[model samples]
Each structure stands twice: as C-alpha cells, then as structure tokens.
Target chain A: MLADQVEKKAPVRRRKEARPQELTTAALSLFVEKGFAATRLDEVAARAGVSKGTLYLYFDSKEALFLAVIREGIVPIIEEGRKLLVAHADDPVRMLREYLFGWWALFGDTELGGVPKLMTSEAQNFPEVAQYYVREVILPGKALMREVLDRGVAKGVFRQTDSELVTHILMAPLLHLALWRHSFAVCCQVPDMDPNAYLESFFDLVLKGLAATPEGGK
Target chain B: MLADQVEKKAPVRRRKEARPQELTTAALSLFVEKGFAATRLDEVAARAGVSKGTLYLYFDSKEALFLAVIREGIVPIIEEGRKLLVAHADDPVRMLREYLFGWWALFGDTELGGVPKLMTSEAQNFPEVAQYYVREVILPGKALMREVLDRGVAKGVFRQTDSELVTHILMAPLLHLALWRHSFAVCCQVPDMDPNAYLESFFDLVLKGLAATPEGGK
Candidate 1:
C-alpha cells in the first residue's frame, strides 16, 4: 500500500517541480528583453504556454517570479563553483582560470547571460530583488574569487593585494561584456568582437597582472 | 547706433546659448533618476524652470531633448580629450594615465557620470539614441584610447596587440564603476571601496599586463 501511494504521487510531484522552472525560464527571457517595469506576468505565462492562473499559482507576483528567476539561475552555478573549488583546492591560479572560463561557458554563453544585464538595469527599481540577488549571487561569486586570491597570496603564487577590490576589478570585464551584449550590442556594432577571444585576452592579462614578480625585473 | 545695437544683442545671444544647456541639464538628471521611458517632458520643463511652450520651442520632443543632453554632455569632454591628446602627444604612457584619471575627474565625478548608466539601462528601448551615442560618443572614446595604444606600440612602450580589443578592456572597469554607482551600489554595498583606489589598482594591473616583458618577469 505504501509503494502504491508513492508511485501514484511521483508523477504529480515531478510535473509540479517542472512547472515553476518553465515559468521562471520564460519570465527571465521576457524580463531581460523588456526590462522589469515593462514585462507583464500574463506575457510570461503566455510565453511559457501556461495560463495566468497557473503562473499565479506558482509565483505570488511578478516580483516573486523575478526573485525566483534569479534564485533558480544562480544557486546551481554557486554549487557548481563550490565543487570546482574543492576539486582544484591545491592550485589557485588553475582554479581561478578554470572557474572564470567555466563560468563564461556555462552562464555567459547561454540565455542566462541576461541576468547581469537585467540586474544592472532594474536594481534601482526593485531594491528587494536587487538585495536578494546581491546576497545570493554577487556576494557568493565574489567570495569564490576572494578565496582563490587569498589562497594564491598564501601560497606565494600571486601578489599580495586587497582581495575584495581585486575581485571587483576581475569581475568588471565579464560583467561589462554581458551588459554590453544585452543592452548596447543591438546598435553599437564592433566588427569581429569574438567573445571567446575577448575572454582569453582578459584571462591572460589578469593572470599576468596577479603573478608575483620582482619589482622592475622586466 | 551700431554700437548700441551690438551691446543690446549680446545678452540675448548669451541667454539663447544658456537656455539649451540648462534644459539639457534638467533632462539629464530626470532621465537618470527615472529612466528615459518614464520621464515626462512636462516634468523636465518644470525642473528647468521653464514652461512647456518654452521647452517645446527648444526641443521638439523628449527624445530630441535626450539627444541634446547626450550631445551637450559628451561633446565638450571629447573636445577636452582632443586637446589633452595634442598636449601629451610625445608620452604615450603618461598620456594614457593622465587621460584615464582626467576622465574620472571630469565625467565620473560629476552628474555626467550618469550618462553611461543611463545609456546602458535604456539603450535597448531606444535604438536610434543608442546608435547615435555609439556613432558620436563611444566610437570617439574608443578612438582616443586606440590612438594612445597605437602610439605606445609605435614607441615600443606597449606590446603589439589588438588596439580595439585593448581599448574595450581598458574601458570596462570605468564603465562598470559608473554603472554600479548608479544601479547596484545601494544594495551590493562594499564598505571602503574608494573609487580612486579602485582606479589606481586598475591602472597598475592593466599597465603591468600591457608592458612588454619576458615570461615570469615584471
């Protein structure tokens, strides 16, 4: 009787779990395209092939949906980074490079690339969502970089410097790339930008900058 | 009689010149605060201490006013940078450093700092404005940096690389800083992250990376 009840509930639970993810995914694209104030919940539901009633059942409001989109997108990435950290615990530079490139591959190169652009564009209007994102996503991402920098400094592989500031600096290029792509890239045409080349150059320059070296040796 | 007419005309000409500046200034602040789509021409006129009729006499529409605001803010800075380039033509490195710091002092430290943030947030909604900005402001800014980089390469002070890509890289941090201040700084608070110190660190790392050197050398 217990096994029969468990089997009967499994499909219902699976469908319930999948519905919110589909709604959030649809919402993310719309929000990124139209921005927070302009996007409507009905449109999100329409895009997701669901009724407004269904969307409402999952999310209390558009703000709640926005929060869910951010949370769902970021949490997995942070968990993945944590696993990467453990895997490369002994090599900070390698870990840093892997993490940066891995992030570009997983997030920046995908539809989720809109997240940074969305946050930067809408943060002022939605302070609560912004605060939640900062706490959940930005801070965790920064902390991951900080750990790598700290470990590098401790191991004498990287120069001693303010980890927090360096983390901000390191993240700037990636963030700018995403923001530009989502916002200005529509009209601001640069010939042959090649995102992969851009990231490669960034990694090269940043790692070289962080390398410990004798003063004026070059 | 001629002398009297010329004297009488002088103040009128001055007032004509100043009205547009004042109007643009008001529009810029409002656009920054509320964003382009949300800002009303009436509010902009009221903010500028002018009637709707007077505002319309100067600018045909809000978009026209936005264009004027962008033009008025950036043209002078570009002109100033042009003068700096001429003044520091001989020292590429010094010219680069001075130009970057001077930009921060002039634009980043003023109300004009909001222009970048404004563009990033609203560019998608206003394609024509974004295109004009790219054609007028961004291309010129990139050109200025490219000129500096090309000069450095010619002088053997900097390594041979893609000047365009390098220009984009150099600009990312400054753009990100302005964008952050306008958008996310409220919630993603980092205590003691001095703007000056951040720029200084950026300069240090970037210069180090661009310096032509042997492997493992400073």
Candidate 2:
C-alpha cells in the first residue's frame, strides 16, 4: 500500500514544486554575467536543465523572470532584516552594526552582489525595471536605514542630522564595493582591500562621525 | 593685412584645429546616455556637426574616440588639481575641502559627472578601456586624495587611518551622486538632496570622523 501511495504522487506535481526556484537561480547568474538585456530566457532554461517552454510556464516574459529573480533572491533577506530591526529596537548601535554586517554577509559578499552592478548598469536602459527595483528594493532598504538613523537620533546616542541624506551616505560605500566587485575589480586586483577590513574601516569612521559628542555637536 | 593673414590659414587647418574637441564633446554625451558599447561613432560625428569620414580623420576607432573624450575632458583637470595640491601642502583641511568641492564643481555637477557612471557600467565590456581609465583617472585621483590624507595625518590635524581604505570611503559618496544622477535619479526623483547640502553633510561627518581627538585620539 505504501509503495502504491508513493507511486501515486505525480511526477509533474513534484517537478512543478521545484521548477520556479531552479529557473530563478539560473536566471540570476546569467543576468549577473551578461546583464539584463543580454540574458536570454532559453539560456536560463538550458542552464537550469529545463526546456524553454517550461521556463515560460513559470514566467510570462524575460522581464517577469528578472523581477522574480530579484524578488526571490533579495526580498526575503529584507524581510528578515525588518524582523531583526524590531528585535534590536532598544540598541540602535547594535542594530546598525548587525544591519551593515548582515548586508555584507548576505549581499555584498555573496553572488547576489552582482545585482547591484547589474541594476546600476542597466537601469537607464530599462526605466520600467528601474522603477520596479526602486520601489521594491531601494525604497524599503532606505526606509529600514532611515529607521535605524531616526532611532539613534531619538535615543541621544547619535548626533542630530538629516536622516534622509544620511541614509544615502551610509549606503554609498556599500554600493561602491558591490559595483567594484562586479566591474573594475573583475580586471584589476585591489590586493590590500580585504572586504572585511574595508567594512571595519567604514564602521569605525562612520561610527565616530555619527557618535553624539560631549561638547554639543554642530 | 589681418584679413589676408586669416585667409592664408587654410580651411583644413582651422577645421583640424577644432575637430577633435567637437568630436570628443559629442561622443561624451552619447557615451553617457547610451553607454559605451551601444554608442556609434557615426552618431557622435553627426551630433558634432561633422561627417562620418571626418570623424575617422581624427579618431581611428570608437574606442580611441572614447579614450580621447576622457583624456581631453578630464586629464587637464587632474593636472590642475595636482598643482593646487602643492600650493595647499601646508593646510590639509583646506586642501581636502578644495579638492572635494572642486570635484563637485567640475565633475559631479556637470556633464563630465556621467563618466564615472559610464565607466562603472561598462568596465567589464571593455577591460582595456577600464585599465586606461584606472591608470589615467582613478589612480591620479586617488593619489591626490591620499596626499591630502597623508599630510593631515603627518601634521596631527587628522587621526591616523589607512589612507588607502579611507580614500575609497571618501570617494564613494561622490561616485554615488554621479551614478545616481545618470541612472536611477533620471527616472526616480529624490527631492530632498540639494547636491551642495549633501556635500556639506558629508564634509561635516568626515571631518569629525577624521579629526584627531584632544585625549591623544585613536
């Protein structure tokens, strides 16, 4: 009876369960390597060991596949970060450290790092994709950073500043690292910069800069 | 006699004198807008109000034309900044401020600003171009900043730090602004950032971070 029950599970249903993830993982690599416009759906399917028709079953168009790749790859990390934000509400400094390090570990230090370069490179060519990326990824990410800065200011642990502008400053170096990794760093070796050391330097400078001074900060 | 002298200057001499600059100017805009791979030499020529054959007379290839655009547009600025560095050798803070603001004025707030974004976006597609850029522009630019940082540290005006890593930190936001202007900011409106105000914030934060503490600082 157990053998018959196992056999009853349809191969199509089991395959369908795993297909979308496989498709997106394949697409992400191609998009990163070839950039968005140059990456083709058939190649993605071939890389995933699926037929082009099967990739279409999961995604209507290449654009849809791209959106899925981004959403699947990054949205979950952001959601997890949001949850961590609530957990670290009482300690803004700790929250800030975790957030930055967590980003480095999750995005900057991973294969997903290429997404930032891909988006930055292709955004002008595809306004719709850029708009969607800004909405789904950029805005939420900035909002989370803004919250961290706002909490620090409110707690008197950090100097009063423009949270919006400061958030952008905080983001710049991280994005720079990611862009460098995918582009110039591909050809040129920057031997001295261990990414961890670079991040440590960034943290030291930024923390010192943001710390509320004993003499009233300007 | 003046009219006769002017007439004696061949039409070809006059045309040749101005052609390179005009071609570079046109190529710069198109490269910034369409990216390196997509931009055509013919379009650069047409935009410069010259014929395709005339463009070939000055620049043998599109790649050569691009290198000229960068060299013509930016190399002199770097050389000028180098001269100013010697003049400000005694005052590192002033030198730093002047350097940052000078960059903002000359590159960040102008069409040349688009070069950083262009380079970042297409560095992979053209490794030779990227190598030339790094050698010509990036290396000299970083060397100037490193001199400022080294001077500041040696004079005990700024805290001792890794001049190399700190230089990258210093450069990131400026690159961010340029990249943003050419990419997402083209489609997405960030209303709060007046470039001057943003730089002001950056200066404040960085200066504070870099300042040597009264208690014989870290």
Give me the candidate number with maximum TM-score: 2
For model 1, residues A134-214, the per-residue Cα lDDT tens digits are: 888888898888999988888888888778788998888888888788878865665647788888788888887888886
Q: Per-residue lDDT of B40-110 in model 1, one digit per residue for the tens?
A: 88898788777778888889887888888998888778878778766899998888887778788888878
Off by over 4 Å in 1: A1-17, A214-218, B1-18, B51-54, B214-218
Docking class of 1: medium
lDDT of 2 by residue, B119-218 (tens): 8777776778888888889988998999999999989989999988999989999999888888898876546477888888898899988999969854
So what's the TM-score on candidate 2? 0.88
Error of 1 at A62 (Å): 2.6
- Of candidate 2 chain B, the 10-residue stretch with the lowest lDDT total is B5-14
Model 1: lDDT equals: 0.81
DockQ of each: 0.49, 0.54
TM-score of each: 0.87, 0.88
